[model samples]
Target: MTGPDRTPPPGDPARDGDAGAAGRFADFGPPRRVDGGLKARSTRGAIGVSWWSRRFLEVLESFALGTRLTRGRSYARKGQVLRLDVTPGRVEATVQGSRAEPYRVGIELPVFPAALWERVERDLAAQAFFSARLLAGDLPAELEEVFADAGAPLFPSGVAELTQRCSCPDFAVPCKHLAATFYLLAEAFDADPFQLLHWRGRGRAELLDRLRALRAGATDPAGATDPAGTPEPSGPDTGAPDAAFAGPTPDVEPVPAAGAARVLAGLPAIPLDEAVDRFWLPPVPLPDRPPTLATGPELLLRQLGAPAPAIGGPGLLERLRRAYRSFGRS
Candidate 1:
């Protein structure tokens, strides 16, 4: 096979044919019937959790029974043929070239959805979940029951409950064909924990529920009000000064006791824009404009008993004259 120079990585699945497995499962026997005596499936344990995909292994680890999935020496690397069958389940192929006889074989890996993993997300302000329980092999008891009830199963000490089968003619002592399938399924498990669960008819939904609870517990309690509360306007004394600036505006009239005409008598007919501009803009030094401040020399002198002209600054008129002089110069 020099076409592409393909060597099946130990435990790598060959989708189309068992020839790729190269006699890996030849010693393994045929797949057992679903209703076969418990001893059939009971005869074989699952590959180790570490042998499967990091993802599915993670979910398994999260379960209370994670360790139950690993069978023997974990066979960290074994060759296998994993394939989707023409019908329902997946198939495994093992080619035995050396032994009592040489033959090509295939077996189905179970892909079911026994327990649904619940959806979960970390509350940023709360816990970092993926690194916690899921990775630590601490699954809860509640979800374990759901998976057990399903015909699909989990290896008591391992991560995934995989199918064991092979096309070998030998008695079912884990002939190479089944071994290849087991190894292949283990490799597949390492690729994605969900794939094994899917075969076992399980999913992440249950894990998600646990995650929800985990995260919920870790989250900081919300304010006395909303956990994520919208801020509210507080008491008048405790609010912003502008927020407290209420009641009749200084600019608004008091309504003048109904019929009493509002006397615009002494007030100047000042434009609104000019008033707002004066209130908002930086003070302007105008050559001809009258003083904006109403308090004057006489009033200041009479109110404060000060000397006539001014204290520290130039006289108002002199300042006005100097401004006019500058304007003329410009």
Candidate 2:
């Protein structure tokens, strides 16, 4: 005699938990069409173009959601996600599923505390390379390492770090609707890694501003006042020469103190009244010819690598290369 029928009844949501039940789910059917939805830039293969975006997608795929991720990728490509908003500690989206009304999905991640971000900003500002690249709107590859060194990882370490929710009736933690949002979100990250940082509780402008302040403070420590709000005693007028030069010139190294003194001593001493007529003029005659232009106007592009996929990817680099060459010629 057959044991008591153990099969779950038809249309039972419990079936979603069974092995390979995702393939048999009726709601897994085609999602409703969406108009003017935020479609992923990548049509096939992987969704993310940048290393950081790929790292995020890699962490999500590691969860082994299996067919759910696949269906979500399909939804992303089909533009089934109507809206996606990423804010501090959270990502919210509206995804069109097989139902009449769209489903709301949200993915939450831990935000670094202000103290931790201050530490991170200090570390980032300490590294000139990091600060320069960030100011130039490029995410350096070592940026995540800097964040990790600050005791706060730049990306979610695992599934446990993320809290996912969906309005869909599917019993999965990340239903297809949420998965679709993930894929699109990866594309968004690829477009601007700052979005990932913004979701971590610090906006791009704020982070950059903090970095600038930290760098400036490091450069001019004497300008900083004491905790008691007392101004430090002024030093000798060593910077007078710099002030006389109308401020430091870009890419020009400052002269050593001894070297500057030697040069100053070598100068023919003359009365201020006698030198007034030629005081603004150069001590020596200027070079007759200007310096030759550096070759390879596209060198910066080569250093920066490919543009974001959302911004035309390789094609943009090629166009920029041509434009640079044209400008150089002109």
Candidate 3:
């Protein structure tokens, strides 16, 4: 080899071939063109369903792959990501690009061990607010705190906790394909925060069932809670009617409908001054005022007539009463 002192010059054909190949390699990077046009975006601007999900995307953007993540936002909105499937510790997806065949993307997140979930479930069950919300088909905002207290974060905090793979020529860990999938998952999390929990391996049903069991076991016989996580009344379930249901006592004659109608009809043609006085001076008794008007059972019937009942059925009166009571409170 030392005998080959006569080396090829820099402008040799072999050198040119090497240089040209390098130039061509650079040119053949990830596709920048579109095929069959870009998909229509489902959402405008940033993509996310809830604050937590938005936070998720924010964290993702902070990664070194910021540029690719930004580009992926458009792909996410445009529905370029065709399929997204999530399982315990993994997310798999297909994303359409300039190529005829869609790119494959995968993401893997840390799976909370079963033992950790047991500790978390116990902690969640201890917190009435969390248990109540979870039972009512919701993920409490306070869940983050619970996880923090447990010393186990529920969401991935950084790239080290995540594994991303994309079947694209780009060497970036999270290429555009992966980014699109991430955004889609963000929106999914928004619609149902439990989806995030599900991504971590425990589904809403399983978590709820476990919570219910834990709550029941932890509940003292003296202070048990109903299935809804509300404390049961201390006394026996005395099947007696509620005080509100006691009704106008048996001895008190019911106000005849005719009488109520006449009373309503005769609501004095008082001048504005008298009407104002009647309204403002609660202490002073008005002449023809009926007691039933105070409790307002027939208030709806008086205002809306029989038509409401006729159209809404027997339950309508109770609903209307509740509505009127709510309005009064407001």
Estimate candidate 2's alpha-carbon lDDT, on a 0 to 1 scale: 0.74
**What's the distance in Å from true for residue 29, model 2?**
4.0
lDDT of candidate 3 over 1-330, digit per residue (tens): 011112234565432344344421222333444544334234566666566786677567655453456667777766677777778788888887655678888888877889889888877765566788778877655566567666787666777788888776655667667778888888777777787888788988899999898776553444457899987665777786643345433433332222123234435456776577566653333334211112344443442332444568647756776787788887
Order of candidate numbers by TM-score, starting with the best: 2, 3, 1
Q: Between the candidate structures 1 and 3, which one is better when assessed by lDDT? A: 3
- Top model by lDDT, which number? 2
Worst 10 residues of 1 by lDDT: 255-264
Candidates' C-alpha lDDT:
0.36, 0.74, 0.64
In candidate 2, list every pair of residues with a backbone clash. Answer: none
User: Which tens-of-lDDT digit does each residue in 105-148 have in candidate 2?
Assistant: 88999889999998778767766767888899888666776676
Which segments of model 1 are wrong by more than 4 Å?
1-88, 99-153, 156-164, 202-330
Candidates in order, TM-scores: namely: 0.28, 0.62, 0.56
Better of 1 and 3 by TM-score: 3
Task: Give the C-alpha miss distance for residue 100 in model 2, angstroms.
Answer: 1.4
